[model samples]
Target: MAQCASCYFVFCLYCRMVYHGVQPCRLRPGEQRAIRDEYLSATPAAKQAMEKRYGRRTLQLLVDESLTQDWMQENSKKCPHCAISIEKQDGCNKMTCWRCGTYFCWICLVALKASGNPYQHFSDPRSSCFNKLFEGAEELAEDDHEFRRVLVRALPHLSHRSRPRLCLA
Candidate 1:
């Protein structure tokens, strides 16, 4: 038995069909649909168990990609130093870019001087982002909830056994 490099689906080299563990392969359309429906309706814990049993890393990558795309759509800021997109999950407007270590204000998108106190930007009335750290906390929370809902909808597709073939060869 060997695993497909692209999809990670195990198969017998000689038989050229998916390995169904110890059971016979159930490739009938009705059986497949029933299994898919069961998985889709499963609880989060059950889905997690399925991910662990099948392909945890793949499922995680899919979830991360979906979340990143959603974040990019909802939040409109890129890290000044690294150019990587960022979303302010919560807290004050002060943001530290995880990729480039650049400290910036989430609201004004200004890079804060490393030599001075970061909170000074918030306190200074002259700064555009002054006293605006928690400006949209409630709205950000609601956006987060929507993101999670989108992730949950995507999980079923990620966990499906019959996902599209990743490689032609």
Candidate 2:
């Protein structure tokens, strides 16, 4: 059988993320996590290996960044001068680099850290800036994004100057 598409899309029956030649899952939606979890526990060595290989935050980061692997996201080009893990705080297009504390405008992604809602339900500087920046590649859908909880789908909003698209914080 062809199997389910998501299985091939995300990972394999072994809980190992499928890099190539992966078949789809044969279970219901969201069943993979539980199955993968149980499967991991059943294998003591593999469970330890898996735990060493991943964690709650890192796994979520992988999901949030999506499998897309954008060049912009990989590097902190948001501030060419400072060049560190910078995040756009609320209030303006100014982004505060956590490492250097330098504020910059759209030249990269609008970062919404935890608690700072960039969307504001309407067009905000962060979202608007980002929307403008991503005006060209709006069609491209992010396969995944930073998922704190599967039940909640909150994402960081870009300022008006940014490519005008939602991006991982």
Candidate 3:
């Protein structure tokens, strides 16, 4: 339930509906620009609150990305997989997809895949670097979990720093 921070209305921008027990919309729109606007226009208290809630890097990106979607439900909300719309229930800046139990937002996953270092908070939060390759299904793994573990441990230190470093091949 992302309040407008001004009106404090608990509306789901993704679904364009008012909230019930759950938000009635699931979307795939990008909310980078709205995040940025909110950040750029935030009062100090709001900025502090957001930073306290989302972390510095997240706060920055919240003010950076300039894309949006209307029909896709996960937009305007934090969804790391770009595929599911679960309620944002934690202040830790992580969202889990009830559809697949996938953790992290699609932006972070895409950033990581694109060499954007979106997982810095991992070390601060005691999360393993191996989350890099710990993706869904054996298909993302292909042959062996052993290889995936190895890749997760080593990718953070690699110079390649792209999908190739995390690729099954």
Choose the strongest candidate by lDDT.
1
Candidate 3 lDDT by residue in tens digits, 1-169: 5577788787654455565444223323465456556777899999886565446555543332332123124323444555444443224444445665556633354223223444553433454434433333344234356646755675554344232434554
Model 2 alpha-carbon drift over 4 Å, by segment = 1-45, 48-78, 98-101, 107-169
Clashes of each: 1, 26, 13
Q: Which is superior by lDDT, 1 or 2? A: 1
lDDT of 1 by residue, 74-127 (tens): 776888778888878777778899888899888778888877798898888997
Please give me the total number of clashing residue pairs in predicted model 1: 1
Q: Regarding lDDT, does 1 or 3 come out ahead?
A: 1
Model 2: how far residue 18 lies from native, Å: 30
Candidate 2 lDDT tens digits, 112-167: 34355534422455444544433323232232332223213332422223222444
Using TM-score as the measure, the top candidate is 1
Which ranges in model 1 have alpha carbons more than 4 Å from their true place? 1-71, 158-169
TM-scores, all candidates, are 0.49, 0.24, 0.22
